[model samples]
Target: MQETPFTLRAGHLLPYCMSDSNKTDFTNPSTFILLGIPGLEAAHIWISIPFCTMYAIAVLGNIAILFIVRREPSLHVPMYYFLCMLAVTDLVLCMSILPKMLSIFWFNSREIDFNACLTQMYFVHCVSVIESGIFLAMALDRYVAICDPLRHSIILTNPMVAKVILAVVLRGSMIVLPYPFLARQWPYCRTNIIPQSYCAHIAVVKLACADTRVNSYYGLFVLFGVLGLDAIFIAMTYIQILRVIFSLPTKDARLKTFGTCGSHLFVILAFYIPGLFFSLMYRFAQNVPLHFQVLFPNMYLFIPPMLNPIIYGMRTKQIRDRLLRLFTHKGP
Candidate 1:
C-alpha cells in the first residue's frame, strides 16, 4: 500500500483535504488563479483607475443625492423618495462589492476563504436583487404619477412609501440569501480558479463536485420570478404611461410626463438589459472569451449604480438645481 505524501505549501492554507474520484490528488491551491484579460496590457493597467474613479463618483454622487433629498423639503415627494432609496441601494452595492474587487485587482491575490468568498457573493447578489426591486418600485411610482396624477399624493404618502420600500428590501434580501447558502454548501471538486474579478454564482457553482441542478433551478426561479415579473410590470406601466401621454391635450403636459420618467426609463434599461444579456450569455455562450466575461459582468454590476445619480440629476430639474445650489453655497 502506497501512502499519498501530502505537503502543504507555505502560501496555501487548507482546513480540509480530500481525494476525489478523478484519481487526481487535489489540494487547495495557494492562490486561486485569476485568468485575467488576455490581449491588452493597457486594459489591465487602465481598468483599476477607471473602476476606482467610478467607485468614488458613485459613492459621493449617491451620498450627495441622498443628502440633497434629505435636506430639501420640496424634494420630499414620492419620486424623490424612490430616488433616495435607489441612492441608498447603490451605495450599499458599492460598499459590498468594490473593495474586494479592488483588492483582487491590486493585490494579485485572489485566494479568498470559503467564508469570505461566500460573504462577498451573498451581498453582491442580495444588493443586486434589492436594487432591481427598487427599480420596480420606482417604475410603479412613475406609473402612479403619470397615470393617476390626482391620487398620487394619496396613493404614495410617506407611510405607504416607507412600507413599500421596506417590503422591497426585505423581499430581495430573503430571495437572494439562499443562493449564497446553496453556493457555499457545494463541495469544490474541480478547479478553484474563478476567472472573474468577483465571486459570481454560476462561476462558483461550476466548481462544485455535487450536482448543481438545484442551484441552477433556484437561480432561474429567482431570475424569472423576481426580475422577470419586474420587467413585465415595468412594461405594463410604461405602456399605460405612453397611452396616457398620447391622450393628453397639451404637448407641454405630455412632454412633462416624459421628462418625469425619461431618466428612470434610461437607468432601468441601462441596468437590466445588459444584466439579462450577460446572464443569458453565460448560460449559452460558452465560446466567448474569459476577459469579456470579467469585463461585462463588472459593467453590469457597477455601471448602473454609478450612472443612476447622474441620470436622475440630469433629468430632474429640481435635483439639478439643488445640486448646483448645494455646491455653490459657500455662505458662512
Candidate 2:
C-alpha cells in the first residue's frame, strides 16, 4: 500500500514527505476558520455584552419553564407538554451556537475541527426544523382546542402527543442528516473561513471546492418543504381559528378564544419572521453588508430562545401566576 503523506500531530493534520503525485490529491481540510461579524471586529466586545446577556436570559428562562412544567401537575396535559418540548429544543439550539459565538467574539478562537463543524451544523439545522414542526403541532392543538373543544382531549391524548413528538424528531433528523454527509463528501481546497459566528449550512457549503449546486438545491428543498409547509399549515389553522372566534355568540367568548392563541401567535411570528428574512438575505442579498449578515443570522438563533419564555410568562395567565408566586414565596 502506498503510504499517505499526511500525519496527525496533536490532533492537527501536518504534511509529511509530500511527493509530486500526492500534491494534487485534494486532501480534505482538517479545520475551518469561523469569521464572526466580519466588519465589526472592534465592536465585538460591545456586541458580546448583549449576546452574553441574551444567552443568560435564554438559559435561565428555558430552565425556569422546564422546572415549572415538570413540577406543576396541572401542566401535565398535551399543550404544556408540547411547550416543554419547545423549551428543550430552544435550550439545545441556543447552547449549540452561543458558546462558539461568544468564544469568537471574546477570545477570537475561531478555528473549528472539520468534523466538529459538521456536527454543529447538523444539530443547528435539525433542531431548528424540529422547532418549526413543533409550532405546527401547537397550531393544530390550538385548532382542535378552539374549533372542536369537545373532542380536543380525545384527539390529543397522551399516546397521540407522544407519537407526534416522535414523528417530529424523526422527520427533522431525516431531513437534516443528509446535509453534513453532502458537505463531508466535498473537498475544501478553497479557503476554510466560514463567514458567520457559527457553522451555518450555506456558509459552510459555499466553502467546498466541489460543485455545491446539489447541496444548495437540497437545502432549499428542505427549507421550503419542511419550514414552508409548516408555515402554511400554521396559517391555515389560525385562519380556521379566527373563523371560529368571530362566530362566537358572545364577545367574552371571542376574546377568550383569541387570548388562548395570543402567545403561540407571538412565538410563531418571532421565530419565522427573522428566519424567513435571514433565509432570503442569505440566498439573494449577497451584496448586503457582512455585519448585517452575521448580526441577523445570530439574531435569528438567539432572539427566539430568549423571548419564548418571556412571551409565555407574560401572555399565559397560569404561567405568569406561577412565576409570580414562585418569586414571591418565602421559605420558612
In terms of TM-score, the best-performing candidate is: 2
* Model 1 residue 297 distance off true place after TM-score fit, in angstroms: 2.1
- The lowest-lDDT stretch of 10 consecutive residues in candidate 1 is 1-10
Please give the distance, in angstroms, between residue 133's alpha carbon in candidate 1 and its true position after superposition.
1.2
Reference-based TM-score of each model: 0.87, 0.91
What would you estimate as the lDDT of candidate 2? 0.79
- The lDDT for every candidate, in the order shown, is 0.71, 0.79
lDDT of 1 by residue, 12-108 (tens): 2122233343234343333343333333324665787888888998998899899888888899988888889889888887887778766656765
Clash totals for all models, in order? Answer: 0, 0
Candidate 2 per-residue lDDT, tens place, 1-332, comes to 00000000011122233334333435456777776777787899899998899999999999999988887788888889899999999899888888988998899897898899889888888888889889999999999999999999999999999999999999988988998898889876646666677787777767666788998788777767778888889999999999999999999989988999999999998887667766766676646666776675676577888999999888888787788779989421
The residue-level lDDT of candidate 1 at 178 comes to 81
